[model samples]
Target: MVFYALGSKFIQEKKDRENTPPKAQEVIYYSLAIGHHLGVIDCLKPQITCKVAEYDAWIAQLPIDGEARRKLEGVKRFGEINIDGTHTHLLAVALHHSLPQMTEQQQQWSRELIALLQRMENEPAIYLLVRRHDDW
Candidate 1:
């Protein structure tokens, strides 16, 4: 009789556990959709652009779990994509402005960026490819 009650209770608890949803991971991928949209040229210009510092500060402020924090640190080691004003400006223009809004040259730049992102998605590892390509 006692064994039957215990077995039923265990089954009920198992069902409850199975019904519960898993916790969400805290680290979010920074993207244009999330308002992390930084300009390539703007990022490139360190002297004039505080975006990298600002982003770092923002990340520090988030209340993330230890796993997410570790992942973010890994991401930070890659450094800001822009060390010069030129790349920062180019990235910014590509992400924020429409082709119609840009001059012909800038439109071409946007097309290149779109292609790059698509290619990156298909590649097995973006960081590995980028590091190798950059000789970093």
Candidate 2:
């Protein structure tokens, strides 16, 4: 009885594998897989610096002070986009850098900033002159 059930389960799993969906979209700046599921195989894998001066105005309006404010002023650099589709998927919080490169402190800052931005009716859209791309 046990063998029979095991065989049936194995067959079902094989059938399921045959029908799995294609891979989900990849993370913007890295090989991180965001939406992969049952069918796709798991291939596990594995910054410049800049100053804050250019962003002075944008930072002034942030409503943050002290360390939080200082860190924002200290970021050196973020990316080198050599991979496909990698140019677009970075977490807005990490700049153009991959998620893994984000330090624990940075992560905390991201969360806090995200929360703060969420509350500001217009802050998220505010442009950062320092950013090379869009205003923000």
For 17-89, candidate 1 gives per-residue lDDT tens digits of 4664533111111221122134322111111122344334433432344333343344357642211222333
Q: Compose the digit string of candidate 2's lDDT tens values, residues 8-27.
A: 11113546545644231112
lDDT of each: 0.31, 0.29
Candidate 2 Cα deviation (angstroms), residue 3: 64
Model 1 worst lDDT window (10 residues): 1-10
Which residue pairs in candidate 2 have backbone atoms (N, alpha carbon, C) closer than 3 angstroms, thus clashing? 28-89, 48-77, 49-76, 49-77, 50-76, 128-135, 128-136
TM-score of each: 0.26, 0.22
> 13, model 1: CA deviation in Å?
50
RMSD of 2: 18.6
Worst 10 residues of 2 by lDDT: 1-10
Model 2 segments beyond 4 Å from truth? 1-98, 122-136
TM-score of 1: 0.26
